[model samples]
Target: MGKIVWSVNFTLDGVVQDPTGEEGFRHGGWFGQFGGKDLDEWAKALFAEALGTEALLLGRRSYEYFVARGWASRSGEWADRLNSLPKYIVSSTLEEPKWSNSTVLKGEAVREVSKLKQERDGDMVVYGSYQLGRMLMEHDLVDELRLMVFPVVLGTGERFFGETGDKKPMRLINARTVGDSLVLLAYELVRDA
Candidate 1:
């Protein structure tokens, strides 16, 4: 069985809007704002994480945005792995996804993901799809929560963890600094045995 690993770059205040600044968000590219050699090196280290990911799970908007934006134009082994990896996009309206190795999952988000976790193997990562990731957490379908916490906080923006009513209990699995400014936090959900 596969683990649904929810991963995102978040502000210390929990904002997870547009980290790349491509979406024209007012406070976009918060991750890139920290300009330093340490930040550059930290970003380069993410390639290993991409290589280790078994598959990607995306929400409709994020899936469409990635397909039309950077990921479609990017190249090399990193791009190869990303583009070639199986992507399961949760979107009721998206009947046909144009990206290669992409599937549009039109079923109920929680049910589809629960089924996927049972059927697939290895780490299935959800990157930057806030709504989909949120739904998974609400359903108790997520196994791990991995966050790259940026030093800066946007007082107003779309939050990574909105008002999801579940109020889950999580145990800290790992916590470490990524660069001079950012910290990586990994948490495993605490479930009843």
Candidate 2:
């Protein structure tokens, strides 16, 4: 079976929105609010991991946002690999995808994802799909979580884990601090053991 893994970047106070200053909310791009050379390499490595992902799960908003960025035009080993992988978008109103290698979930996201996990394939990675993450968590579909915690905090904005009434508990699998204040935290859902 495959794993439903979530990889996301968040602020110290847990905000996960507009870390690149290219979005709304006035004050954005908090991820690079403070910077260093090593940090760049770390970010690159993180994105490289994402590129190697076999499949991507995204919400309608994040899917549209990413597709608009011309990810296919970017050139690199990572870009090539990322553009080649399959993407599943969870949406009701989105009738079509502008990006290549994209597909819409035909039915309930939880059921579709559960079936995908049952298949013999590679990791099903989820990036920046905050609302879909919450829904998956609610349905007990997420197998693992990989969070890159940045140094600063945006006093108000979207968060990594939203309100999902206790569908399952989480167990910390591993954790480490990278560079000065960044933390890499991984957790697994405690379904049975």
Candidate 3:
């Protein structure tokens, strides 16, 4: 069985919206505004890992955004393999997946992801699907988490964690400084027996 992993770029305060120029968040393009040498180095490392993934589990919005230009438009092994590897999207309204080597996951998101994890053969990664991420976290479907903590805070925007009825405890397995102030945190969900 393959592990379900989440890789999300966030602010120091945990905001995941547009931080650069104007492409990240839906409203303001404040995501990459603070990207410097450190941020670049951090991004390179993150993309390297993302490239090694065998599959991508995305929400409807992320699926559409990624497929809009096709994964091949990007460089490196990740882009090449992503274009050829399997992509599973959780969406009810998306009638079809236009991207190559893509599949639309129907039915309940949590159940489908659980089933996929049980049968998958390699690394399965998920990007910024807050809704699906929350659902997966609630059901205890995720195995690993990679958090790229940025330097700035947007005060308010989309959040990585939401009210999922309870707090989920995680065990940190790895921690490193990527670029400048960006912190890359790798953690595992602690399960109670």
Candidate 4:
């Protein structure tokens, strides 16, 4: 069975919207606002995670965002891996996926993703799909979380997590500082028996 790992970059204040500023969020581009050795380290960490990922699980909006940003045409080890990996997009309205090796999951998000976890092996990483992530967490389908928390706190924006209606316990598997500004945290969801 595969684990659904939700990997994302968010600010100190839990804002996960438009880190790249491409979405035109009022306080966008907080991701690239910092520079230096820390930024490079963060990039390396992301690349390492991408290398280990078995497949990509994305929401429709994130799929569009990546496609619009030209992730498909980009070249490099990381870009190549991302482009070639099997992309499972959770979208009811998307008729056909434009990116290569992409498939649209048209059923209910939770059920579709739960089936996906059983069919695949290794980690199916979800990136920047806040709504999908929330849904998965609420349904207790997310197995792990890899969060790279940036130092800045964008006072207002869409947060990564929402109310799940109950407390979800997590065990911190790893914690480290990436460069000088970013903190990388890995947590395994503690499921009830």
Candidate 5:
């Protein structure tokens, strides 16, 4: 069975809105301010995460942003792996997805994801799909959660965990500081074990 993995970079205040300033967000670009060994380690961690991802699950806004942000244009092993991977976008309103190996999942997200979790594929890595992530989490479909938590706090923005589905218990499998202040945290949903 496939596992749905939700991975994202978040601020200390739980904000996961736009990290880059290009999205016209007033408080964006906070993620790029860090550098040195910490940044390097975090980047390496990101690469490792991508390497393990079998597919990508994204939302409409995030899908457009990723394509516009030129993730496909960037030439490298990461770019190649990222762009070539099967991408499933949960958007009832989206007509066509231009990216390679991209599919627009028009069915209800929760039902579709439940079916997806039963597939014989590898892990399904979710990027910046806030609404979709919420739906999946709310439906108890997410198997693993990863957060690259930064040090700064943004008082206002869309948060990563504004509220979980319910009182779902999570087991912290791994937690470590990636850079100067960024912490890479991994948790598994405790359904049984």
Candidate 6:
């Protein structure tokens, strides 16, 4: 069965909004503040993670964001892998996805994702889809979380975790430093019997 892994870049304060500063969030561009060898290591870590994942699961907003940023047309190992990977986009209104190997899941999000987990055999990573991530967490559909935490703390903005009603316990499976400043933390959800 497939594991739904919600993986993304986060700040010390849990903010995941507009790391590139493209969006007009008040604390936008927190990701670009760091540089030097550490930033190179961070990029390498991100590339490794992308290469390791079997597929991509994204919400409509994130799908649009990536497409708008020209990831669909970019030519490189990372961009090519991303464009070639099977993508499951969870969107009610998106009738046709323009990205290659894209599939739209228009049914109820929880049910659709649950069926997806049963049908696939590898990890489907969700990146930059906070709303979808929260929904998956609430429904107990998320299998793991892989967070690349940056050094700075954004006091305000969209966060990775929201109100999920109940506590979702997790077991730390891996923890390491991506660079001098960036930390990679992987946690598996502890499911009840």
- Which segments of candidate 4 are over 4 A away from where they belong? none
TM-score of 5: 0.92
Prediction-by-prediction clash tally: 0, 2, 15, 0, 1, 0
Residue 169 shift from truth in candidate 5, angstroms:
0.8
Give the Cα error of residue 90 in candidate 4, in Å.
Answer: 0.3
> For candidate 3, lDDT tens digit of each residue in 1-193?
9998998888878877664444644545655465678757875886688677879999998887777756646666657767777889999998878877888889888888888998988789898887888888889888889998877766888777878777778899999888667788999998882
Better structure of 2 and 4 per lDDT: 4
lDDT of 4 by residue, 1-193 (tens): 9999999899999999888888789999998898899889988998999999999999999999999989989999989999999999999999988899999999988888989999999999999899999999999999999999999988999998888889999999999999987899999999883
What is each predicted model's overall lDDT from 0 to 1? Answer: 0.85, 0.81, 0.80, 0.92, 0.86, 0.91
Error of 1 at 160 (Å): 1.4
In Å, residue 167's CA in model 4 sits off its true spot by 0.7
TM-score of 2: 0.88
lDDT of 3 at 79: 74
151-179 per-residue lDDT for model 2 (tens digits):
77678998787776765678899888776
Candidate 3 vs candidate 4: the lDDT winner is 4
Candidates in order, TM-scores: namely 0.91, 0.88, 0.89, 0.96, 0.92, 0.95
The worst-scoring run of ten residues by lDDT in candidate 1 lies at: 37-46
How does model 2 fare in lDDT? Answer: 0.81
Model 5: how far residue 4 lies from native, Å: 0.6
Best by TM-score: 4
* Candidate 1 TM-score, true structure as reference: 0.91
How displaced is residue 44 in candidate 2, in Å?
3.2
User: Which ranges of candidate 5 are over 4 A from the true structure?
Assistant: none
Worst 10 residues of 5 by lDDT: 160-169
